[model samples]
Target: MVFKRRHKEKLIEATLFWIGSLTIIILILICLFLFRDALTLFSTHSFYSFVTGSLWYPTADPPLYGLIPLLLGSVLVTFGAICISVPLGITSAIYISEIASPRVASFLKPFIEILAGIPSVVYGFFGLVVLAPYLQLWLDLSTGQVALTGSVMLAVMALPTIISISEDAISSIPSSIREGSLAMGATNWQTIYKVVLPAALSGISAAVMLGMGRAIGETMTVMMVTGNAAVIPGMPEGIVESVRTMTATIALEMGEVPIGSEHYHALFAVGSVLFIMTFLINLAADIIKKKYRFKLEGS
Candidate 1:
């Protein structure tokens, strides 16, 4: 009976190990497939021009493939979303985790979760039918479908992630830490800001990074509202201008692009760039979390 149990345990361990290995293998295969098609574009297109070019007319007479505009559009929209989501999300998280009564926290938590579960397409439709028109009327813009509109919608989509994760992080702090601060004569707000917040800083940072990743990777919402113009957005008023993001560009053009054409390859290159951006964001978040966790544990 002992031998039989040991054999079953070994079988289970081997099965789990192979499952983990298979997941990694699949991810590697996906990366290979994306990069293989992406590299084909550089073979016929100028790498320098592709990276630095401002034009993106893939179906024009000569088919310009400049990537700067799309890259900048994505950057502007994502930055805007981060600015809006991080503060609001973190603040709400703090309230729910620390300040709010149990009843309020319970109510708010489920609402945020529901927001997270809502379809991205529904958000896009709302942005189109409701938010855009209101913005146009209020801002007196020629059209409401601009980078700012995309930012607003993306922020709404990213808020639930940032808030939920941050709340959990803050809530995970040892109650003794708060009690110690209170025992030291610190006020409630001071204890929260100086003790609890610092303790959960790693998790909060991770949440922000993950939220930014989601904002950058979002396709349907941005495509619907961001005007889809493939031009470098001018500053000071750029956020109010129509611009096309990398994801929007891919989603918009992939269907019509010829299967083996340079346009198709260029789209793949865009996907590769997006993959790298999200990968780096996640890597940075992981590193930050580990560094802070190690420091917290050591101290």
Candidate 2:
């Protein structure tokens, strides 16, 4: 019986290891596919022109394929999204983890989870039909679909991820730590602000990175709301202006682009860029998670 149990455990371990390896294999396959398709675009255009040139007119005679405006648009909306989500998500997590009564936490947690579960299409529709008009009226914009509108929708989508992870991190801190802080005569607010928050700072940062990744890669909502105009903003408030992100550019044009054409390959190249951006973000999250896991364990 002892030998049989040990055999079973070994088999389970090997099975789990193979499953994890499959995920890496899948990621490699995807990157290779994107690179294969993107090579056609690279053969004709200089790397600097592809990345730095401002124009994106793919249908004009001898079409230009600069990624600068799309990259800037993506950065603008993502920055705005992070600005909105991080503070509110962290605050709400703190409230739920430390301050809220059990009943309140239970009630609020479900709603936040529901927000994450909602389909991206639904969010896009809501932004288009409801939020857009309000934003145009409030900001005095010519149209409702602008970078700020996309940012608002993405911030909503990213909030649940940030809140869930941050709350988990704060809750994972041993209760004894809280007790020790209180025993030192610290006020409840002071204990949370100085003790709990600092302890969970790494995890909170990981949560923010993950949320930012989600916001940056989001396609439908950004496409529907960001006016689909590929242009670089000139001012700080230019984030409120109409713009189009890389994801939106791919989603908007990939269908009509003929196969084997430069336009089609360029769209694939854009997707490759988006893939690399998300890959870097997930890598950062992984590093932070491993670092903090060990740090917390050692502490």
Candidate 3:
């Protein structure tokens, strides 16, 4: 009986170990596959011009690969989305975590989760049909599809992630801290603002970082609404004009490229840029979180 039990335990341990190893190996293989063309971008002289210059005529005979225009479009739209999402998302989360009744929170939480589950393409279509037209009417722009419209759509999409993370952070705050603040004659709002928020600052920062990641990576909605022009105009002028993003550039052109063409590798180069950007954002978030945690511990 002892031998049988020992055998079973060994078998399970071995199986779990192999499963974890295989998963890591598979992930590495996938990363390599996706990043293979990143190397070619470095080898080409056009790489600098592609990344730094504004011209992006990929289909031109010599295929100008300047990525600045696309990069700018992405930044503008993401910045707008972050502006819309961050405050609203954080406030909503605070309300749910610190203020709302249990019954109300229980009901609302699922609704927010449902919003996250909605498909990106659905969001894109919604932007195309509804938000775009509304923006055009309000701004009196010639075209409804623009960077602002894409930003609005991305904002809506990022809300779920932001709200969910912020809520969790606020909820994780110790009830004792709230009680102590109240004992000090602080109002509920004061307790939340002066005590709770500072304590959960790391988590809130993480939530914002996560939302920014989502805004940056969102493709379909931006593709549908951004008008897909590749011009490097100033922010004020570009806001009114059409624009393209890195994700949209790759999505739009990848299919038409011959399999082994420079264009194909260029798409991978864009992917590498995106990957690096996300990685750096996540790293920054981590550093912020650790610093905040240390501050809390010291206090």
Cα TM-score per model: 0.98, 0.95, 0.93
11-88 per-residue lDDT for model 1 (tens digits): 999999999999999999999999999999999999999999999999898989999999999999999999999999
Evaluate all candidate structures by whole-model CA lDDT and list the values in order. Answer: 0.97, 0.92, 0.89
Model 1: lDDT to the true structure? 0.97
**Candidate 1 residue pairs that clash:** none
Ranking by lDDT: 1, 2, 3
Tens digits of per-residue lDDT for model 2, 227-250: 988888767877778999999999
lDDT of 3 at 96: 94
Best model number under TM-score? 1
Best of the two (1, 2) by lDDT: 1
Q: How far out, in Å, is residue 70 in model 3?
A: 1.1
Which RMSD values do the candidates have, in order?
Answer: 0.9, 1.6, 1.9
Point out where model 1 deviates above 4 Å. Answer: none
Q: Which regions of candidate 3 are displaced past 4 Å?
A: 1-16, 42-45
After aligning candidate 1 to the native by TM-score, how far in Å is the CA of 13 from where it should be? Answer: 1.4
41-135 in candidate 3: lDDT tens per residue?
A: 66764656867877888778877888788888889888889999999999999999988999999998999999999999999999999988888
